[model samples]
Target: MSNLPQSLSLNVPFGAGPSGVVPGGAGSAPAANKDRKMASAEQLVLDLSNTELRENALLELSKKRELFQDLAPLLWNSFGTIAALLQEIVSIYPMLSPPTLNPAQSNRVCNALALLQCVASHPETRMLFLKAHIPLYLYPFLNTGSKTRPFEYLRLTSLGVIGALVKVDDTEVISFLLSTEIIPLCLRTMEMGSELSKTVATFIVQKILLDELGLDYICTTAERFFAVGRVLAHMVAVLAEQPSPRLLKHIIRCYLRLADNPRACEALRHCLPDMLRDGTFSACLREDPTTRRWLQQLLSIVGGNRVSPLQSGGGFEHMMVN
Candidate 1:
């Protein structure tokens, strides 16, 4: 997923061709040429319905997704566009089992996912995107265990779609996700994905934890809290070896959010990794003042300096209290 917020500027030029037009450069085009470009992009959207034209159209739109600031409604309102995108996803299911997904095929499905991410990001289309159960279609990609480039790209892009949904403030997005296996899926990524993919997955979890309902859900059971806490603790240890300020920032935010719940906060007092409360990450977080502040606040709230029975380098799982 791109580091930019998923909710930021997803408009597509509905009728424009895939000229990859930049906003500043559009004013320089002749009026007649602009009309043609609009017609071409519209044709490209329409061509999504054509099996022969779909691949090229998907490529053009996906390549220039950032420029499609106004096209989400058009994509959603247009007939068969969403279906076409899902078709692109489902077609690749066969290859996933055998782990035969080459870069070319992965790129094609990822392109389709990019379009879906746009739809997932737009307010007008977001609820509709969820109502269609579209996010579930991408979970298979997230569940795959392959470390190949193609599979990694697929996982990262799929996380982008979920990340886009959670970027919205609505409880409905969290509600939908909490009802699914998204938490475990994200935890799996946090454990095994590349640094970038792990960052996106952790971002998704951070957004979820920021939601009130999501916080309650995670803390509702000792099992759930420990499930999330253990993975986060493990990631902190891994990053301590080879730091990623970006991923570490999200992980810290998640821990801080978990601290907002009384029970979870109490559990964290015993189970929160020393690396987070200690000065271990100070160098890695030198430029990130906000994360540094969050770390301090989390430590203060969880009574960070106190030693626990589990502090003898024991696993976080053993620190959980009933």
Candidate 2:
């Protein structure tokens, strides 16, 4: 390969030397042959015409999980090629049109995508997926066929891949996803998904909302407490009604994080009573020490009083230094 550049000199003819050699240099034919062979092998790996073969290659690549560091350069080298293939597949298959992956294929793709996520150093590759408009491709599957057995399984796997991508940086592609009605779609999906799917949706939503950009968008859409109170009320009610310890902890954490903002704090206060009544708050109080501290801090922030359970004989004094 290194000698090819030298062999193909400006003086080289198309083909005029010893049997198969170029006019300008020796060994050009062998070098060109080797280069062609290498290109063919690479092309075979990326070719998507044979879905089974393409799927198998991805599966094999995924199995070599530890090699991701080594494979990073290759993935980067072929990033544009692979991204084009992915785009073509999504465009042709269209996730909405009666689904494509069988159980095995769905599992394989899910595992491969998950493994690929481990090397999400390729933000540009992720951006390619985003630019491919995968969210639009995925939204219909969330409601497909009323979430049947295998269908639901496939949907869950798809959501897992999408969720992983969203959680990567939260900034790389989320702004674009949110701009396209993905937020409301996700909220609706959370409302309708099975427990596992709901959990995934919850995590993604929390990641999105944790960022200032996402919170700003949510605030814009919801306006004030009254404007978004119904949505928050519904989310709080759902958490209260279903009562997953994991979800409860995350909800409390999100509230505490949001409470750092005065606007979010005011909005949260409107929903606090229902959240408390529904036992979401109590669930957190019982399950999370962090939540207990946050509650104490929240009390201090709101009430302007320092009542410490740890302090003994006298209340701590607040002194203003000049």
Candidate 3:
């Protein structure tokens, strides 16, 4: 069964002026301005329903997303708007099967995703967005192995939606994601995505690890811990050759959080990269004291030990950070 709806309709209107407001009063002008803007936003959203107008409407809505603080609910409750966005996503599946997505298709879908991200970020509608299972629709894009500009942009924009959900420190967000394939998808991106995509994917992982339940989940099994550890090890080796302080910061924080788990810390004693321990990243950490301190805390917690199961030719051996 298709995970998305063919169409949906909700008729919550905007731009109604508050009752009992006197004309030309101090409060009236601001209310009038608010109504006009809301009306314009509503028009832009309504335009999304028209087939010919969908592309320009999506482009405009995405560009002006921040301007409409109420845009999330507006997108959700407006007639046919959310369906239009899903249709935009559905239109791209054929391209994915054939690996034929172009820049134009990628941009349009990303614009749709940007609006979905807005919905995911809003406090009022985030859980509602989750209840509708909207994030699952984005997973295929993240799962793509293509490295072209089109796929890369699609993956990054899709990550932005998940990143927005996790950005606000909510256990529900972590809980929802932990229940899905988000982690493996993120790990794959961390392994193969461009620097920026990897950074966002790592940021998502870092946020998950920061949550207590998420930490317990990842550390609940050696398999999960080593899966994450191996990828972080690979990223560290890559960063050692071509450094990115931004990406390195998230990677280190994930390690520091893992160290908070006793078993993971024990595993890290042997498998944690040598470069992280030997000041290879000192220059990179010079400007970022918080991450520098995180690295220190991780080293201190894992301590100076190199004896563990991972030491005996675990999958991480080839990623030595020399």
Candidate 4:
């Protein structure tokens, strides 16, 4: 399943965006000044090889947020070397192994992941990140935690970055992402991750299901179609077992996105009638009046043989007659 779908339409390559980052989006800078900035960014990336210099450079770049996006391409260029370095270090932690924080290594990779997160919103930089397999590089951070603050810092930041990656509207990005192990990884986070991890994972799940990849496309694929059902089941199960306000809110918000996505709602209708008929959904509906109303709206969107008024958000007025 490593191959992507042929239907994907990749955006125009990043080099086509702009020749240079216009400061404050004000205007283009002089050729000489642009050249100087590129030169400096290049040097800063090279300095990442030195632990002390890497920290300093990251600090400086963090202070100037726009500068980071401006330098996104340049930074992405250097990440290969950074990833190679990270790969060499992560091997010592065997499978199912808890990570013991390696301070020097953690500091370097954390900063690098942060930088990648900052640059990720750009379409071109996202393409670069995926091509570089930067997500795989960040995988080790999510699986382990440390008593050491630095290691914990890496895990938390990694969660946020993973969430941020799903914020794009690019089908090609999501298309490529589905070819990787990220979906399963997110499921794992939902199952065993910290509270914060669960929140970020929820955001990522919502974004991927509702925004990044069009629901129509996702529904056409057998695997993705089933995958979406599994996610909905897990979310409902989590809500049922240990009803927390925060988790409930995430699930509610996720469904809110689904309410507007008729294709996704249609897909859910096919799978959820069983849950609806068996009273599983009704049990959840009884949790609270406010939430019950939201669930009713969701059921209205997801009209079924039994769960009807057939008044879905997409206006299926004649559906009941059918």
Best by the lDDT measure: 3
* Candidate 2: count of backbone clashes, pairs at least 3 residues apart or interchain: 0
Judge candidate 4 at residue 134 and give its lDDT.
Answer: 70
TM-score of each: 0.86, 0.61, 0.89, 0.59
Question: Model 1 TM-score?
Answer: 0.86
Q: Where does model 2 exceed 4 Å of error? A: 1-52, 70-73, 79-105, 108-124, 127-136, 143-145, 166-172, 223-232, 235-242, 273-287, 294-322
lDDT of 1 by residue, 188-301 (tens): 999999999999999998998999999989888778888898899999999999999999999999999998887677677777898887799999999999999999899988
User: Which is the winner by TM-score between candidate 1 and candidate 2?
Assistant: 1
Off by over 4 Å in 3: 1-29, 308-322
Model 3 per-residue lDDT at 189 = 100
Model 1 lDDT on a 0 to 1 scale: 0.84
Model 3: per-residue Cα lDDT over 225-276, one tens digit each? 8899989999999999999999999999999998887767667878889989
> What TM-score number comes out for model 3?
0.89
Better of 2 and 4 by TM-score: 2
Ranking 1 against 2 by lDDT, winner: 1
Q: Each prediction's Cα lDDT score?
A: 0.84, 0.52, 0.86, 0.57
Number of colliding residue pairs in each model: 13, 0, 0, 0
List residue ranges in candidate 4 displaced over 4 A: 1-43, 59-69, 78-98, 102-107, 143-152, 211-247, 256-296, 302-322
